[model samples]
Target: MKLINKKNKKYIQVFQLFTEEEWTKSAKNYNKNISSFFSGKKYEIFIHTNEETVTYLIGLGKSTMQNFEIQQVAVKFSQIQKEKIQAVPTLVLADFLKEKQFEEFVKGLLLGTYSYPFDKKHSIWNPKFEIHFENLSQKKLDAIGTKSEALVNGQTACQEWLNKPANLKKPDILSSYLKNLAKKYDLKYTVFNRKKCEELGLGAYLSVNQGSAYDAAFTIIEYKTTVKNAKTFGLVGKCVLFDTGGISLKDHNNMHYMKSDMGGATAVIGTLIYAAEMQIPVNIIAILPITDNAISERAFLPSDVITAYNGKTIEVLNTDAEAG
Candidate 1:
C-alpha cells in the first residue's frame, strides 16, 4: 500500500491509531455500545461498520513508544487489516506526530506490503494507502513517503539476500552484487580477493574461507558523506555465505537454514544503502569477511592454529567455532 496525494476520495475503511491514554479519555465520552466492544489495550483492534465506510480502531498501549515500537504498531495495523480491507485504506494516525515518528509510521505502513522472498517468484504490493493526518502538508507527506519507501526497499533487499538458498548465494554472486551496489551509489568499494587477503595477513578469516572450493574475499565498503566533520562508524558483519561447520560438522536436521549465516552482512548492506540514499551525514566503513565454511580437501582441521589480521594467533579448538 502507498500514500496518495489526492484527497477527498472515498475509502473502503478508515484505520485509526490510538494510544492507551487517548483511547481512555475518548472512550469515556462514547456510547456504552461502542465502549463495550473495544478497549484501548496494546494491539487491540475493533472494526465498526458506519453508514457506508468501515472504521478500524487500532490501539498502541502507551502514548510514548520507542521509535521501533511506533513502526511496529503501524506494521501490525497494516498486516491485520490486509485480510479485511483492500485498496485505498485511509489510516488516521493517533496524532500529528513529529517528523521522525511520522516518517517511521509511514515506513512501517509501506513495509506491510512487503512479501516474503522466493526464488523465481514475485508478488506485487498494490492498493494505494492514504494518510488522514490533519496538519501534514502534501509536499511533506510526499517527502516522508519517498524516504520511508527507500528504507523499506532496502530492508526487503536484505531479506531477499538472506533468504536465498546457498547455491544461489555463492561467493562470486554475492560479491558481484556488493560491487554493483557500491557502483550504483558511487561509494568506494574495495574487495580483497584470496591473494590479497593472504597478503593482508588475514589468516584467521582465510582459514575459515579455506573450507569451500568457491573463491573468497575480504570486502570493505565505505560510504563518505560531504557533511562537514561527519563521524565515521566502523562496522563488521559476518559474511559466511553458508556455514557447514567445517570439520566440526553440524547436525543435518536444520542445515538448510545455514543460508542465512550471512545475516549480519546482509543487514549492513541494507543499512548502508539506505544511509547513502538519504545522505544521512555519516561515514560508514563496513567490513564483510566473506566465505562459506563447507567441507572440502582444504578445510581447516579442528585444532589448527592461525594468525589473525591484527597479528593475534588463534587455535581452532573446534572448527565449528570459526565465527562463534
Candidate 2:
C-alpha cells in the first residue's frame, strides 16, 4: 500500500471523464459487488488471520459530516478493538465529484482509526485497519492524504481531550490544558472568571452555566501576526462543553448526544492549533465559552431575555436553544 499524492493526477483526470449518471451507476454497482462478497458471511475469524477481517461500508451521510459524531463513532469502534477485532476494513461511500464529501470521507476514516484501546485485560488492542474509498481518484487520494494528515492530528487531539470523563476534564483541568498549549504556542489567552462574566454583562452565557458545580470559563485566545495591527478573523464558538439543557432539562436519550454540543468549540480550537503550527500568516481570535447547561433551580428558563456581547437581546423561544 503506497500513499498516493498529487503526482498521480491521471487517476483524478479519469474520474472527471464520467458523467453524474455514470458515476452514480458505477458507485451503486461497486456497492452491490462488495455487498455480494460479504453475502454468505463466509469470512471467519481465528486467532491470527487478516483474511477473516471483512469490509464494512459506512455512509458519509447525505448531509455534511459532523466532527463530533465522527469522534463518537471512533470512540465506539475503539471498544470493538477491546474485543480483539483487529485489522477491520472500512469503505466510505462518496461522490468523487464533490470535493468536500471526499475530504470528509477520508477524515472520518482517520477518526474511526483513533478509537483503539490502549489497555486490555491481558493484551492491548492497538488499531490496525485498511481503509478503502470508492469513486476517489488517485489524485484525489493524494490530495486527501496531504490534507488529512493535519486534520487527523487535530481530530486526535480533540478526541483525547473529550474522551476523559467529565470528572477528569472539568473546567479547571480544561483551562490548564489550554494555558499550557497557549504558552507552548506563544499565544495570548484571557480566561473570564465568574466575576468577570458578571461584570462583562454576559448574562446569557452565565445563566446557562449557573448550575455547573465547576467554574465556567470564557477562553479568549489570540494568535498574533508579525505585521502590527494585522486584521484578525474572530471565531466565536458556542462552548457549553456539556449541556444538560439546564432547569428545562433534556431527556436521557437526548443527553447522550449533548456531549457533542461543545463540538463547535472543539473544532475552532483544533483549527487554531493547526493554523499556528503551520505558521499561517494571519491573526486569529478564538472565543470559546465553555459551560454546562444542567437542570437546576439556578438554570435559566424560557421567556428570559438575555443580552449577548454585541448587545443583541435574544428572547428564549426554546429553553433548549438558550446560549450565553
Candidate 3:
C-alpha cells in the first residue's frame, strides 16, 4: 500500500460530505448534480467520469461522524471499486473531524481492502492503492500513518491466526507463536506445559485437555510500563484451538469453522502486539488457556463430578459445555 501526500493531484479525488448542501458544494467542481446522480445517503457512493478525470463522492448521512460509520463507508467503497482504484485523494469536508477521525478513516480503508486467501495459489483482489489526505498538517499525517499501519498489521495477524486450519494451529503451535512474539516485542511471557499445569493445580484448564492427543498450554503475556502506580489490566482468553463437542458431538455440517473457537485468544494477542508497538503507558497481563475438546476414552463424561483448580467439585451436565 502506497501512502502519498496531496501533491499528486492527478489521482482520483474522493470526497466525504455530511449533508446534501455539503455534497452539492463539493461536487460543483466536477460539474455534477448530487441528487440527480445519487442519493446523499450515508456510505452511498456516486462515481462521476469526465474526459479529464474520475471522482467519487460519498455521503456521511448525518453531521456527526462515528468510527464504525467511517469503516462501513470505506468497506462499501472498497467493495465497489476493488483493485481498479489505484490512487485516491480523500477530501475531508467536516472541519470537526480531528486526528482520531483521520486515523479511523485510514484504518477503515486498510481493513476494507484486506482479503485473506488462505492456502490459495493466488488472491482475487490484492489492492495496492495509494491513499492521499488533503488539508492535514505534517504531524497529523504522520500520526495517522503510524496508527493506521499498526492497527491494520495487528488485525491482519489476528485474522491469519483465526483462519489457520485446526491441524496446523493446535495448542503447542499457538504457544510457540506467542513465545516468539513476546521475544520479538521484548514482553515477558510464561508458557505452562501439561506437567507445569498439573504441578500448579490448573485442574480446570487441564480438565478440558484430557481428551486431546495434544498437550494443553497455559500462556501468560505481560507488558509493563515505566509509569508509577499504573493501573493493571488483566485479560483472559479462551484458547480452544478446535472444539469438536467432545462426547456430545456436533453435526459434521459447518464444523470446520470450529477452528475459530480460539478467536478470544487471537484478539488478546493482537491487542498486546498493538499496545507494544505503540508503547502504551499501561501494564497488561494476558492469560490464554489453550486446549482442544476431542472425543476419546479419557474424555470427561456427562454426569461426572470433577474438582476444579479452586478445589470445587462440579457435575458436568454436557461435555459440549466445556467453555463454561
Candidate 4:
C-alpha cells in the first residue's frame, strides 16, 4: 500500500464506518433496502451505490472496543472486501478511532491480504492502493507503516516456515535457514552440531535425534541493541521439525500434522524478527533445540536415563513425551 499526501475527492470505492448509535441516527438518510439490511451489526457490511459513487457501510458495534477487537473487525472487513476495494479507495475512519486503532486497521489489512507464496497456481489476490487519511501527522503515518510492515513480514515468515513439509526442512536445513535470518539482522548466530551437543552434555536432546537420518543441531540466536543497560529476554523454543513419536508412535490419523511440531521455534523467530524490524531497545537471546524424532535402532528406548543440557538426569518414561 502507498500513502500519498495529495488529496483527491473522487474515489471508485468508499468505506463508511459507523457505530450502532451513529448508524441508528444516520440509517434513515439512505434507501430503505440499505437501511434495513444494515443496522450497524458488528462485522456486517452494506453496500450502497448511486450514479456517482459506490459506498460500503461497515458496522462497528460500539465505540468501546478493545484494541484487538478493532483489529479483529478490520481483518474480517479486509477479507470480506478482498480485492474489491483497493484501487483509489477512500476509508472514512470514524472520529472515535485513535491512531492505535488506525494502526491495527492497517495491520489487519496486510495480514488478511497475505497468501501463501509457494502456491502460484491458486492464490488470493492482493491489490495495492494509494490511500490518504485526514488529520494524521507524518510521524503517526510512518509509525503505522513501519509497524504494519514489520508484523506482516514477521508473521508471514513463521507461517511459511511452519507450513513447510518436514522433508524440505530437516535439522540441518532448518539451522541454515536460521543462520541466514540471523545474518540479515547482523545478530549473533551459533549452531552446535551433534558432536558439540555430546560434549556439552545435551544428552536429552541428542537422544531424541539419534534415530534421524540428518544430524542434530542446537541453534542459538542473540539480538542485541546498542542501548546501554538494556534488559535481556531469554526464549527457548523446541524445534522438532517432525515428531514421529519414535518408539511410542503417534496415531496415524493425525501424524502428518506433526510437521507443525516446529511451531514453537518458528514463533520465537517471528517475535525476534518483529522486534528487530521495529528496532526495539532490548536484547533477545533465543535457543532452538532442533531435530526430528524418528524411529530406528539408534533411537532411545523407554526407561532410559539421559543427562540434559543442564546436567540433570532425565528418566524417559514415555518416548512420545520426549519434547512435551
Candidate 5:
C-alpha cells in the first residue's frame, strides 16, 4: 500500500497507451512500431518482454478519460494479471497525465482490487501493493495517495454493507452500526425509535415498516469540522434494509438482491465516514429512514392514505413502490 517516486528502484512498469504518437514515444527503447502489438483499443493489454524486465502496455481508447472508466480498466488489468502481480513495487509511467488524471488513476488502481465473497469461506489474498509514479512530484503524489485511500476505504465500506444479507442487516442493526460508527469517529448521532417516529409524524416512513417484525429506525449523524464558516450539507438516505414488495409481492426471481435496497443509506453513511476520516472542512448531516417492506395483515393497503412528515397526504397505489 505504499506510494513512492523513485526512478532508480526496480519495479513493474505500466504504460498507458492512448494514441500512435504516445505509443511511438513509449516503444522507442523496444525498437517496435505501434502496430506491432497494439492499436490503442481501450482496455487492450500488451505484454512486452525485454532482456531485463517485462512491461505492461494498456490502451486508453479515448483521449479524455473518466474516473469510472479508469477504475474499470484498472480492474480488468489487475484481474488479468492477478497471478503475475505480487505485492511488489510498481511504476506507472503517467507523464502525459495531469494531476487530476493521475489522482484518478491511482484511485482506480486501488479500487480495482476490491472483491466481495459474502459469508462463504475463501482464501484471503494479501492486498498490499506499492505504486510508484515516475513523472509526478512527491508532494502531489502524496496528496493523491491520501485522497485515493479515503475514497477507496469509503467505497469498500459501502460495498460491504450493500452486499450484506437482509437477515443480518435489519433496520435496528443498521442503526446501531451507524451509532457505533458515529461514536468511533466522534460524530454526533441520534436514533428515533418507533414511538419517537410516531411523535415526529414520520407516517410515510413508518408505514413501510408496519408489516415487518422489526421497528423502523430514524437515524441522524452529523460531522462538524473546525473550519470557520463551513457550509452545511444535509443528506437523506432511503434505508430499506429489505424490500419484499410489501403486500404487492415481488417475483421470486432475483428478489434476493433486495438486500441492496439500502444502497442509498450506505452511500450516505460512507460519504459521512469519508468526510470525517479526512477531516474535510465542511459540516455534514445525514438522515437515514431505516425500514423493511414485507407482507402481513398490518401492512398498509394499496388504497390506504398516509400522512408524511411534511403533512402531505399520499394515497398508496402499490406497496411495492414503498421504497420509492
Candidate 6:
C-alpha cells in the first residue's frame, strides 16, 4: 500500500472521476486478484476470479435500476471507509441481469481522503480505489471517471452550503448561489417574485415567508436528462435553508442548527446538477420553496388558513413548524 504523505495530492486526485470504467478498472486491479459479492434477495458471495485478496461482488438486486439515490450509496461507502483497507478496488453491480431493472451506483469513494489537521490528528493513509456500475458499456466507462471528478467538486460545494450559519445562508443569498449554479450548468430556472407566488396559489409555502424581513421567492428548476423519451419526475424540496421561528418563538439558542433545514432543497439542487452533468435521461421539475420566519408586527399567527399552490389549505397549528 502506498502511504499518503504531505506532498501526495495524487492519491486524492486519483478517485476524482466517479464513473463505470474507473470503477471496473480499479476493481479489476485492487490487488492482482479479488473476489466479488452481490446482495439482493439472498446474501450470496461469489468469486469472479481466482485472484488473491478477497473482492466482494455485491448486487443491489431488484429495483436497482430505479432512479439513483446518492444517500444509499453514501452510507455503504462510508461503511467501507471505516474498514481502513490501505487500498482496494471495489465495483458494485446493480441489476446487470435485466434491462430496465437498472440503476447506476453512485458513491463518495474519496470521502475517506478528507481530514482536518489537528494536534491529535492521525497519520495519512493510502487511497482506496472503487467504482460502481449498472452494466457495461465502453462509452459509459469512458465517461465515469470524469463524472466522478465532477461529483467531488459538487460535494465540496454542498459541504460549504450545508455548513454556513443560518443568518448568513439567508434566502436571498441561497437563491443567488443556486442561480450561479444554474448559469454554470446550463440549467433552466425561474425565480417567482413574491407576488407571483400569491397568484400561483402557493399559500402553504408563502405563509412561511410572512414573518421574514426579506421577501420570499419560489424557484423552479429544470434539468434535461439523457434517457431518450424518459418520463419526467418532480422533486419538491422545502428550502427553509435557514429557519427562525416567527412570533411563535423558541429559545434564542435553539435556532443555531436551523441552517440545515434546507437540506432537502440542497439535495434536490445537487441532484439536478449531477443529472445534468451525467446527461441522465430523465426530466425534472424541481421546486425550491424558499423563506424564513421571524417575529415582527406583520407576522402571521396560528389558526391562519393558508392555501398552498396545490390548493391544499394548512391550518397553522404552530408557527415554529413553519418550514414543514
Candidate with the larger lDDT of 4 and 6: 4
**lDDT for model 5, on a 0 to 1 scale?**
0.76
Clashes of 2: 6
For 1-324, candidate 6 gives per-residue lDDT tens digits of 121112221221222212243345445544444323322221222334343433344323233323343334433543454454324444343332332122123323333333332111111123344343425564555555557545645554556667776667788898898898889888898998779988878787677777778888899888876668899999988787656676567677867787787778877877887777777778988998888766777777888887777777778777875434
**lDDT tens digits, residues 1-324, model 2?**
123322221221111112233334544544455433322111111121134333232322223434444434333433444344334333333343365545653454355555423122311122333344556577777767667656766666676656655555567777888899889889999999888999998877777777777676989999887877667799987776677766556787767667667677778778777777666678999998877777666667778888876788988755664432
TM-score of each: 0.85, 0.58, 0.85, 0.91, 0.88, 0.59
lDDT per residue for candidate 1 within 1-324, as digits (tens), equals 455444456666676767777887788665668777677666788887757778788776677677777788778876666566655556464563576777777777667655566221211144354565655677887778778867876787888898787888899998899899999998999988888888889888889888778776789999999989989999899889989888888889988888998999989999998988888899999999889998989999966889988998888877873443
lDDT of each: 0.77, 0.58, 0.72, 0.79, 0.76, 0.57
Which of 2 and 5 is ahead in lDDT?
Answer: 5
For model 3, state the Cα shift of residue 197 in Å.
0.8
Q: For residues 207-305, could you state the per-residue lDDT of candidate 4 as single tens digits? A: 898988888788899999999999999999878999999888899999999999888988999989999999999999999998999999998888888
TM-score, cand. 2 vs. native? 0.58
True lDDT of residue 127, candidate 5: 39
Residue range 1-324, candidate 5, lDDT tens digits:
666776654555444445345665556655556467686566888887666566777776666656566667766776567667656556677567777766766676666666774221111124355667767778887888788878877887899899887778977778778878999899998888889999999889888888888877788899999999999999998788888888878888989988998889889988987898799999998999888898888998888899999999988888874533
Cα lDDT tens digits, model 3, 1-324, are: 444446554544544444455665555555555568665567777776667556566666665656778667766766566645644343444554566665666677667665664321111123334555556776677777777767776887789889888888877788888889999999999888889989888876777788989887788999998888988999998788988888878779978989998899889988898888888889999999889988888888877777788888878777773533
Superposed model 3: Cα runs more than 4 Å off: 1-21, 25-29, 32-34, 87-97, 118-130, 321-324
Best by TM-score: 4
Pairs clashing in candidate 5?
Answer: none
Collision count of model 4:
0
Where does model 5 exceed 4 Å of error?
12-20, 31-36, 50-52, 64-68, 118-128, 321-324
**Model 1 C-alpha lDDT versus the unseen true structure:** 0.77
Superposed on all Cα atoms, model 5 deviates from the true structure by an RMSD in Å of 3.1
Provide the clashing-pair count of each candidate structure: 1, 6, 0, 0, 0, 26
Off by over 4 Å in 6: 1-109, 113-143, 322-324
